[model samples]
Target: MDTTGWLATQRDDGETVGYLEPLSGDYSLVQARNLLGHPVGGPTEFLEAEELLIDRGISELAERWSLRDAPEELDGGVVILEASPDGIVVAHADLAKAGVYGRRVHVPWPDVDLLLSRETPAARET
Candidate 1:
C-alpha cells in the first residue's frame, strides 16, 4: 500500500480546492497549493487511500460507462480513464480521434470523490 501524503486543499469559505500529492518528501504544501489557487486552510492529516478502479472484476457499468482502455462503443456511453503518476496513458474512444487522448486531466481527489460518490486513494505507480 502506498503511504504517500496528500494535502486536501480547501478555500477559506469551505469550498474544496483539491488534493496535492507531492512528488517529493521535502515539498512545501503551502507553496504548491498557493500556486494552484490558495493555501490549504484546513486540517492536514495522513490518510490511506485506494484506487476505486482496480485492474479487473466488474468491467462494464450498465452500458453507461467503461474503462479507459476498453474497446470503442463497448458500452455506448462515457468511458472514464484515470491519470497515472505521469499522466493519462489511455483515453476514451471518442476522445482518441479528436487527438485529445493520453492527455492528463489534473483533477482533485475531492472532485473525484464527488464523481465516484466515494473517496478513493490516488492511483499509485506500481
Candidate 2:
C-alpha cells in the first residue's frame, strides 16, 4: 500500500508496529508487514487505531498465509520472506528443496491474493 503520508505508530521499544492513515475525519489502522503495509482496521478514532495495532498487529505476522491466483509453484503454500513498499518476497513451503534452488518471487503487494492459511506454521510443526 502507498503510505507516503501515513503516520507511523511505534512500540515502547521504538519498533514500528503499524501506521495511522489520515482520512477525512478518522484514521485507518494499517498493520506493518515487515515494513510493508496491510489494512486491518480503519475509519476509527486515531487513538483507537493506534491502540489496536499495538495490541494485535505484531502477532498477526506469525499467522501463516497462502496465495491465490498466483503461479502454481507459488500456490500450495508459502511464507513471506520480506515485504517492502514495492512488493513482497515469498518462498514455497517446500523450502528445504525448492528454496535451495532459489524459488522466490516478488509480486506486487496490492495485486497479491493473500489468504489466511487453514494451517499455521505451529500446526505444521506438530
Candidate 3:
C-alpha cells in the first residue's frame, strides 16, 4: 500500500511489526493488518497505537485465513506463508498436513478477499 506518511513500528530485534499513520494532533491510526489487509486497530493515541502493535507482534499475521471466491484449485483454508508490500504467498492448509507440501500461490496485496479463518477465536466471537 501507499505508506507515504506512515511510521514503522519495530520489535526489539528490529523486525517491523506494523505501521502507524498520523491522524489529528496526537492521534494515529494503526495499520497492523491481517492477511486480508484489514486493520485490527482503529484511531487512538500515537503511543497507544504503537504499543498495541508492539504488544501484538507479528504473530497475528500467522493466523489462518480463507480466500473468498478463490480458484477451485485452492479448495480449502490457507495460511500466509509469506507477505510483503508486493504481495502474499499462501499455501493450502492441507498441504501442510502430514508434512506433505505443495505449491504456493502469490496474490496481490490487499486485492483479494482474505477472511480470517472461521476457526479463529476472533472470527468465532464475531
Q: Which one is best on TM-score?
A: 3
List, residue by residue over 8-112, the lDDT tens digit for candidate 3: 678799987776665654444444543335565766777787778778787755666676665676666666778766677877766766455476778776543
Instruction: Determine which window of 10 residues in candidate 2 has minimal summed lDDT.
Output: 25-34
**Which regions in candidate 1 have their CA more than 4 angstroms from the true location?**
1-3, 29-66, 69-74, 79-126
lDDT (C-alpha, whole model) for all candidates: 0.33, 0.59, 0.63
Best-performing candidate as measured by lDDT: 3
Candidate 2 local Cα displacement, residue 85, angstroms: 2.3
Give per-residue lDDT, candidate 2, residue 126: 61
Ranking by lDDT: 3, 2, 1
The backbone clash count of each candidate, in order, is 1, 0, 0
TM-scores, all candidates, are 0.27, 0.67, 0.73
Candidate order by TM-score, decreasing, is 3, 2, 1
The residue pairs in collision within model 1 are 50-121
Q: Regarding TM-score, does 1 or 2 come out ahead? A: 2
Error of 1 at 75 (Å): 2.2
